[model samples]
Target chain A: MTESTNTPVIVLRGLKKHFGVGDAEQYALDGVDLTINKGEFVTIMGPSGSGKTTLLNVLGLLDTSIEGDYQLEGRAVNTLSKRQLARIRSRQIGFVFQSFNLINRLTVIENVALPLTYKGGLSHIKRLKKASEMLATFHLNEREYFLPYQLSGGQTQRVAIARALVNNPSIILADEPTGNLDSRASHIIMEELSDLHQRGNTIIMVTHNPDLTTYASRVITMLDGKIASDTDSLLGQPSVEFKRPLAMVVRPSTDNQAANSQTKPVVTTLSKVDRRKLKVAVRKRQQIAKNRAPARHAEEYHQ
Target chain B: MSRFLLSSHLQNARHSLRSNRSRTLLTILGIAIGVASITTIMSLGDGASQVVAQQISNLGGNLAIVRPGPSRTNFLTDITVPQGQNYATSTLTDSDVAAISALPHVKEIAPISVINSTITGQHSAPAGTPIVSTTPALSSVDGLQLDVGQFLDSNISQNTAVVGSNLARIIFGTTDALGQTAYIRGYNFTIIGVLKPLNQPINYNNIDFDNAIIIGQDIGRQLSNGSAQIQQINIRSDSAANLTSVVSSINKTLSAQHFGDKDFTVLANSDISQPTSELFYAVVGVTTSIAAISLFVGGIGIMNIMLVSVAERTREIGIRKAIGAHTTDIVWQFLIESLALSLSGGFLGYIAGYGLAFMISTALPFYPSFNWQIAAVSFGLSVLIGTIFGLYPAVRAARKDPIEALRYYS
Candidate 1:
């Protein structure tokens, strides 16, 4: 696992995923070879059953049964054990599903910070602080303690996004992020991801509506687990451009930096000014948790 | 599994139980009822024996009662009574008391003779007024209290009698009815003294002193067919420390008198109260086992509800696993919830059980005894039931595939 600056974050070659047996068999992902570099906002567009989600799941390292040379950051993912694959999934990949699957009984912060538990380094308080900062970025600071059942469709998706980004994963794989949301909510979510892309975070989104492809740096349409068409010149040229100065762009590391930045990852990416803001965010959240600790104690047995 | 993960599992379990309030309460109620039954039975058994033991201890601690019945000591052997036996075989006689009195360290001997006959008072005499005849040493041997009249004196051959307060009031129209003529079967007797009211009605004698017509052994023989059959012989040792020597001497004398048959028992302290105590333990054993069956059924009910919960929360399990929960974590969640339910039921049932025991004690003679050992047992049994029955559902929950669980709609 060499720390190479020019290495691609995701590399898939001759990927084939088969389902069922004999005559009844069909390929969910037949033969797909794809390469996604660092900070490339790749949008996968295809109709239903076009293997769009299967490709995203394979890239996310969630299901590893495919017969292919699937290398993530110069390391062969197939060679890695289940525990190591889970570690890669936790630190490198953040998934946002169409259903916005938040745990029923857990609160907003609990759902957001769940990925950090698998990564395992910071205390519960520190993890909560980091989750709170992510939620605050999406203007959901006050809704941190709310349950998933109490949230609307749009709010639930935003909380799910916050949960995905809390672990500071290099790539965000969204399988129909706005599939359940209204047009207005969908626009707000796309704008947040567009801003994240301009700040050099790689995003691979799967969508049914082609209107969402405008936010992608490279729009790749799939047909029968094969690339039907690809707008390849947009690899470094995303349609949605940021007005903010690119001078504050942080160098995104491709090595195993995800597992090491336990104490702070947001700090690792921020400039001096934004870094202090994150510190204050972490401190304020800790204070709020200290204040809410007594109330949480009362509700602990009741819940 | 870290401390935070364990705490999270417990918190999720509590939340799951709290979601469906009525089902949780009903299940808890079932467990509580089961727990209360066993606890009440055990407490009452302990309490009754405790009260009897305390009462026995209160009586100078130097007394031992010898009754004419089947020897409980020789339980394995088949003992029979003479033919045509009524109430109990009259195996004791007045000579037994006299012979026991001659033993060393023997202070006093009271021989009890029984005669059940109707009495006619000036106003009214109770239909079942029993006549108990004993020697003048009865007051010293038994803790008999007199209200305002004198007991029968052995020096006098006069047909005198002492009536219980209730019987005296009925037969003579007053407890102070001194020298009032009362008809016993066919003989008329003068009531010399009025006995005190004994609140304790049913004793080992199976006789209520409050409704008894007490007379001397001479009158008892006359009331019967000129033959007095002693029912029991009560001996009072000089001191509690002298009980062993006194009992051994009495046993030796009785053995010789019975021609080495040893059918009669010479008891001291707890030995005298064994028959009733053993009866209590038997009753408790039968009732506790029945209550245990109810608890087992209640445990099954918990398992049934937990299985339903696991099935219903399949989607929830998927969401948790997707967010990074291990398979063992799901199992821990449900097990904790079941434990919470039964343990809560146990706590509530313990309080209710003591309440039941206290209510029963007032209706009966003995008081309910309380001990921490039974409390621990009751609580521990409910917890054990919770864990033992909750296993199947928890394992089922943990074994579910994450992909399939997520695909489930409900």
Candidate 2:
């Protein structure tokens, strides 16, 4: 998990992001100071309203009107013009949003080629070729011509990932990538992310689920717009205890049929006892989802 | 702003606009209407000018006209018949005609005296039938062809007449009206000849000769109480080479004849078509400007629809910005979409406008002219309107905050 030179890819110092002014002011990100090294798969976990997405957005350079310094690869972000920052984002940063914000009108290949469109020199044919190649890595080559709505939840998320990596950005920022996926789909996404991390790409992912952090080399937890815990370990050890067993907790399922169809091949290889455990885990996650569904809606509204 | 990015943006703009095919087409239709009006006006105006020019060229280079108008009127004010006492005071006398005929290189002289009177034969003519009183030389000067019988005799005092084919039909109910008597103001005059049909109604004379009754100057003076209004004089030079010298000599002689009043306009060649063409242009210019106003309103329609489009595509804008599209790129995208709509409209309008012009030309004496200048102005106007009307909405899209924009789900 150790990067050879330990070169810092991102640096944030006393960064503050606030909404409104004076009496009505509220901080979305309050004085965050952190340094992420090259090739680190850092997972950020926090409850709702804890500023995880805000931090991710700021780190991705999607938000730059903050109080303090932000440096990406040793260049201060504040000094760059909006056009320059956008250029940097196009060339160096890849973003994955929770909703899998694939343009609904575009075909999957077109959606994946979007980032490369902002790139200056690459021809249209070359960009689509690169997108096709990226889709192949995600085993999504056959679905290139299909629209986003035509793809299953897992496939849509994979296409989103393909779009993110198509530009060969230096860092990937994912905000709740599996937030809408079922357990088996989440497992597949996590495996793909782990494969990317193994190949030495810097990835920062935000997630509500604690179990997903096991794939990360380091973990950070936020509370009330500030980081409450940061740890560099082989496996993430979140300070907050979850209601379910650590090994048994699963991603909340949004679509049961899609989840079942996707997990069928993997489920058949498991033993009878493990299959039963999987079913039990699924049931608990469903119950947790029902109880927490309204809160999730409220949180999205606040965001 | 590279070519690749621009092409991609154009492709995306096409895709997005195609998604709302009806709205795009409607917007394009608005622009097309504006362009169509302009093209139609321009084409028709040019056609009228071309017809007048064709008429003047047909008259031959040696011909010169002397008309009762201000010798030195402002060209701008004279475009629509300048308001003045020149018409009431200016007169062409017989001595003026005699003096012009004595000028060197003057081949012939024909003075036209218009006497307003109703003629009656087999049928009484319309109330305002023009009774033109001229000499026998008018046949050669005005290019009057004798369809069946002889022209007017040289005897100035003879009570003889000639009838245009149309007038003959209106009076005698036949084209061969030689030796037929026609009554004008209680005087019976024998129709000595029947003139050929002249299809051209719009000419320097502004008279449809096909509908005229021509009589000898002496009898016309008796009918009009010896004070006939001499409206114009047609002069033919000996040859095309001597036309300039003849015109100058006649101008000097006529000015001296009127005691240097110079209340006459001597016109030759293309100069003869100027007044008529200018009058045509003024009328067409007014109608064209009205059509231009409608085009401006169409541009406003484009602006209104573009604003609506920007609002609906807020989320799309957000997604693009979030994916690293710059503010200028967003502006270019929307601008290109509007340009596509407007340019397509322009192309459609150009074709439609010409169609309308040609259709209208069927009822007109001339056909509408088509040229590259009209096409260039039309397309240039469309591009300008698209850029201008598309700008505000594009800037509005570009000004959107990525965070707030992404929050827009629709």
Candidate 3:
């Protein structure tokens, strides 16, 4: 069970996930090969229905009915039982979703630390303490007892990310984690992810925003369930702008106030014509903020 | 999946039930009512049986009765024997009583004769009272305790009788009924004593002793065509330990007296109160089973609420699955939720059942005693029903695909 971090953490070769059978069969992930090494922040970009989610699901061990050779940490995962896969997923892979996916009935800390329940042998009190520390990392220590519904979109996403990393998973799989946040909140969340990346955590993110690739060490664009363009876009990375150290995000701050009451739906869920209008508005803002690199990055990443 | 974490699961289950207060309360009420009815019914059966057994034991530990046929008396059936061939027939005779009395380990015996004729003295009971005629030994053999006067002695005169406390008050209008005149079967007799209340009316033979008129055997035989049929003979052994041997010897003596016609029954060797107990068990069983239907309905309520809860929390299930929760985990969550509901209902039902039992014991003649078995059964039934009914819905919740659940709308 001891796996070194230097090994190729995930290797997906000829991964094909079909939705139906016979004439109705449609490939969700059609013959895609991708190998992600340790400490690599890989961002996946594609239009909707381009197999981005299916690929993420396959890698995360949430979907197994796919023909593929998925080797994780030098071990072949295809033959592993569901229980074993679940253990591996719990110990090594964490997931962050566009919807936050926090259980509405549980408090913020319970939602954050629920994945630890499957770990077994961990005292619940100690688990809560660990969850408290994880929440502190996102400057959310004060709101640990709040319910998911009581939280703002940004706070909910932070709680979700805290849950994902509570087990200390080496790889975090995020499916448009910032998709639900407002422009300001999205910047703060992305900044936290960037901090995590600097601390040598491997992250695989699926997003519709092509400009978010600037945060990734490698970017793979998909088309019709295939990797149409694989680019190692390291030069345009946001490393130069993140002058503050990663440890600073976890520092106790007295002024970290709650998010405002005003809330907006995740941009992707908006109607097509409204989304188009928003995108056009974002592009105009980007052009005006071209002189400012950080502002331009935020506009591109969100749009 | 690794560790059960029972406490945590219970806590979470309780939390979810609390979220829907009204539905949970209704479900609890359903199971509680069922439990209460079952407890009441069970108490009735237990109480009735205990009362009969205690009554039998009170007749003296070594005592046994030989009665005709399988006709044991219960309050639910006829309590006064009719005057006809059924009562006039000598299924047993005075010779049988003498023969049993002469057996090894045998003690003195008393044969009982019942006459459903009215006995009034200065006042009446408004209904015909039963008069029992037996020898002097009848008092000790049947464990009768007199309040004021001695029982019938060896007087050849048929002019003396004993009245029970209630009848004494109703007839002679006083507990000092000794030496008072009473009319029985158109014959005037002087009351020699007033009997204490027996506390119970039902006995082996169909006679309410508390309201009955007791007289010496010879006088009663003369009144009923110079000889009356002996309905039952009460036998008391020298030692309780030798009761079986005594009963066997009595049977042998009786069989020989009847030329080997074994038409009589010995109480210690047979189900003394079988028919009555069986009737009671049948009635209680049927009624309580109907009450159990309420528990079944309560379980269905839990399942209905759980199904709604699962559907409402589809996204929660998906999130949990994505975070490495096994199907077993999901199943346990829902199952525990359902269990919590039923068990709470059961607890409420237990309280309510005791309440109903109290009301019933007061309203009815049967004195109910506490029974742990009934509590155990009703509580266990609630939990069992919860598990059985909750399984399908819990399995359905577990079967949801993470992707599909994630996309589910409100």
Candidate 4:
């Protein structure tokens, strides 16, 4: 397909998701505005209760009933029915969970063909054939008949990736794709994801590891249910300095000059002790903010 | 509901069901027992009626049997009254037999007078060995065969008798005792014939001919003090086509002779096949209702197992939903599993039922029959039960929220 470089794939404005009622209410996602373009790999990092996973769920259309104006591919998704959203999820978006959710009873090929089984009109033979071809791309042809437990952690995640892409969805959503893997396995998964990015597939990944963000075209960091900083840097850098920003202003970007100008130079001199102290201080401030909203923090516990 | 998706769902269901082999087998066993009883009961009931029907056809379609009282008797009366004791209050007499014999199309008529008495012939026999007195036409009307000598002659109404094969053996010590003298009610009678052996004891005739003696009608009346009660009469028309006319005329003649009391029943064709009156339907109906209750219990067992299966597979449902399975897909997966369970049970029950039926039939007079209709009904009922019981659990699995489901650990 022919592609425009700056076409907006996802746009969210004033998106708010809250839990509980009245005095016990808490906003998991509070007034978040963001835009993701086609073929751009974005990585999100935040503290435990910062609504990063919730935002990913909303973007994947797995969660609904939120206050928002969200358009996917220029079509308003907030007005779509649950069934229509499911259709969009199956046909246009793919999700990769941290646990590598392959059905334990199914063989590797059958697990990879799980998504195609839900789509109408394809026979089981054809679905398996497609799954076999997808597995061949990952060099997993010999393990087609092996169950999930029989595969190593890296092979299992690769099978999950093959399953997610079996239908050739428009965007891939990975919620800590390497969460359960060791460094070497995580490196291999990151390289496969980068290869997918080089092939023009849009990827939105959630991770706690800072080193993996070097593969992203842009980086977004959230704090206290809101975007604390959004930057277009660290595409291929080895080390970087953290930006301490209090909710940066979000705007529509047609190659915005201000964001490019705010790109801080790489800092390779920061010690591990200094980074640890910065993380500890950030956590202490977050705890104080959570303490100030006593009712909301209590509700978060209930959730 | 696409064909491709249906096949895929079927494969998935098969895989899951096989994984839990013990549970599936136990659940299937419940349905099997229920279906087995139903099949066995149906086969036995149909087999008994088939035997009686075969006997009726063998006697030729031109025959009609007349007995005392109305043809339609209730279940209570049939069970309380022992076979021939119901004939005590019978209104039939020798005149009714004479009146029926005068009909236009009637070829031959034989009135049976059961004289209850003991006999002394070289060696004494049982006390209540019935001495049936009838005309020589009885041999033709009842399709009886003689092993030796001749049947009672109608022209010579003397003290001549024909003994059954078993009665001959009991009183005279041998079936070859053709010239044996038997004393009945203080009158001496010479045995002229020995009947051929008949294996059919449970027949419409209600008489075990193997232990009975046959004498002339005049002797039967003399023994009963000239007030002999005619218990039953068997009439045969010249041709099968003349049966309806002969039966109607006999009914009219008997009604007119008894001053239109209508106390006699003339039965032919379909009515001849009714064994032990209408008790056939009553027994079948009661037992079939019991079988239905068992099937209902079996259905409940299936529902319980399916609910447990759904609970155990909650995380599996979540994983499938996360991978893009719709609500209908999950529902069909479980539904198909239950269907597979019950349908296989039905098939096993069909084979087991026939085996049981054949085993029991060795003691019975008739063999149980096998047909496609019974197989079809067994399978149809199995499908219905599976659908009814599997639906709720399947729907529960389908309605689980994908987000909550994916987070489930078990």
Q: In terms of DockQ, which candidate is strongest? A: 2
Compute the lDDT of residue B148 as modeled in candidate 4. 94
Counted clashes in each candidate structure: 4, 0, 2, 0
Worst 10-residue lDDT window for candidate 4 chain B reads: B78-87
Interface Cα RMSD for candidate 2? 1.0
Predicted candidate 4 versus true structure: per-residue lDDT over B44-74, tens digit per residue:
7667767767877888889898988766567
Off by over 4 Å in 3: A1-6, A232-303, B1-4, B44-60, B63-138, B147-163, B167-194, B202-208, B213-235, B243-290, B364-367
Local lDDT at B265 for model 3: 66
Question: How accurate locally is residue B144 in candidate 1, as Cα lDDT from 0 to 100?
Answer: 76
Q: Write the per-residue lDDT of candidate 2 for residues B156-262, one digit (tens) a residue.
A: 33778888899899889999898899998889888888888987666666566888888888888788688656778889998888999888887888788778886
**Residue B194: error of model 1 in Å?**
5.1
TM-score for chain B of all predictions: 0.72, 0.75, 0.72, 0.73
As for candidate 2, its clashing pairs are: none
Q: What is candidate 4's lDDT per residue for A1-303, written digit by digit as tens?
A: 112147789999999999899999999999999888888788887767888998998898877788989999999987888667767877888888899988898999999898888866688889999999999877788889999999888889988999988988889999999899886577667766766776788889998876666566667877657876676432233112323322222322437656655653222323676466546645643454445442332222111
lDDT of 1 by residue, B1-410 (tens): 67776666676667888898899988888788888887888777666556555656877888877766546544222112221123665777777877888888888888777787778878657665678888888876767788987887888755888888988777777788887888877887888778788765535444567888778887788776877777678788889999888888877787888888867766688765432433444556566666778788889989999999999989777666555555666678888888888898898888888898889778877766789987997889888988998888998997776657867887
Across A146-240, the per-residue lDDT of candidate 1 in tens digits comes to 99988877788888888888878888889899899886567657766766776778889998754566566677777667665555532343334
For candidate 3, the C-alpha RMSD (Å) to the true structure equals 10.5
Question: Measured by TM-score, how close is model 2 to the native structure?
Answer: 0.75
Would you estimate the TM-scores of all the predictions? 0.62, 0.75, 0.75, 0.72
Model 1 error, position B131 (Å)? 6.5
Per-prediction interface RMSD in Å: 2.4, 1.0, 1.5, 1.4
TM-score of chain A of each: 0.75, 0.77, 0.76, 0.77
The residue-by-residue lDDT of candidate 2 on A1-303, one tens digit each, is: 334137889999998999899899999888998888888888887768878888988888778889889989999999999989898888888888888988899999999999998877889899889999998777777888999998888889989998989888889999999999987678667767866876778899999876677667667777668776666421343222221222222223546757565452121123567556646755654454455442233222111
Cα DockQ of the candidate 3 complex: 0.40
Candidate 1, residue B201: how far the Cα is off, in Å: 4.1
Candidate 4 Cα deviation (angstroms), residue B322: 2.1
